[model samples]
Target: MSEVPSPRLRISDQDRESALTALGEHMSVGRIDIDEFGERSAQVTAAKTRGELSGIFADLPEPHPLLDAPKVAVSEPEKPAWADIPPMQRIMGALLPILFIASIALIITTGVTWWFILVPIGISAVGEGIWGKGWDNAHKKLGKQRRRELDG
Candidate 1:
């Protein structure tokens, strides 16, 4: 079995700051995107604190390319609409149990059979799951449609 390399020494604050400064210089010279610079800077900073950043800097390219180019800003990725639905459905689905319990409490308070509440709750849960699944499938279909449109 091949032995894994032991972890390297933790990065110091000075090392992290220096790396960030270098990365900023790279970004300023258009060697790297703003998003890339920000991401790498954060990664280096976090890794320094957590002792994980050392391996990253070991194989350094001497005199990096960012020393000469003009700076450019990075464009953000567009957000998809379906990102909103899953969470909303999940929250509403979760609430179903609490609502069912409350309904049962109300029925008991009125001296009615608690069993009746089970039918509605069960039906609602099944319906919710089916609806959520259908919505997800629809989103997938839309994504496929968009991809086909783009490809064509």
Candidate 2:
């Protein structure tokens, strides 16, 4: 008669605890979904020791197989220089010329060369536009950084 292969032993307590800790860290950092975290935690808790934990993991398919596999890093699509500018900034930029014209008309109506006022108002509008663009760029960068860190 042919001999049968022996079944693998279950994990031991120490290993199971270690695995649970690692799974907890992953879950805390939002790497794994709630369901996956619960399932893995249950598996680890069920294991009595290290060997049993190893056996349990060995039987399961690789988690994030894609992470283990080689992959090309995809570059983000090129954003237009103006794309980083916020809608409000873009709208303000569009209105700058009109504002400048209105300011000149006001200066003429007042019989004062309030052209000086135009300079400060134009500068302020430009500053706001620049500030808005910077804010948008920072937000985009932060979002990308978070996604990279989370492997999402």
Kindly give the number of clashing pairs for every candidate.
1, 13
The list of candidate 2 runs beyond 4 A from truth reads 1-7, 48-152
- Give me the candidate number with maximum TM-score: 1
Per-residue error for 121 in candidate 2, Å, reads 96
In model 1, pairs of residues that clash are: 29-69
lDDT of 1 by residue, 1-152 (tens): 97643445454565566667777776777777888777776777677332355444444443322222334568886555445555655555556657778878878788777776886567575755767544424345446657976897
TM-score of each: 0.31, 0.27
- Would you give me the overall lDDT of model 1? 0.59
- Scored by Cα lDDT, where does model 2 land? 0.58
For all candidates in order, the CA lDDT equals 0.59, 0.58
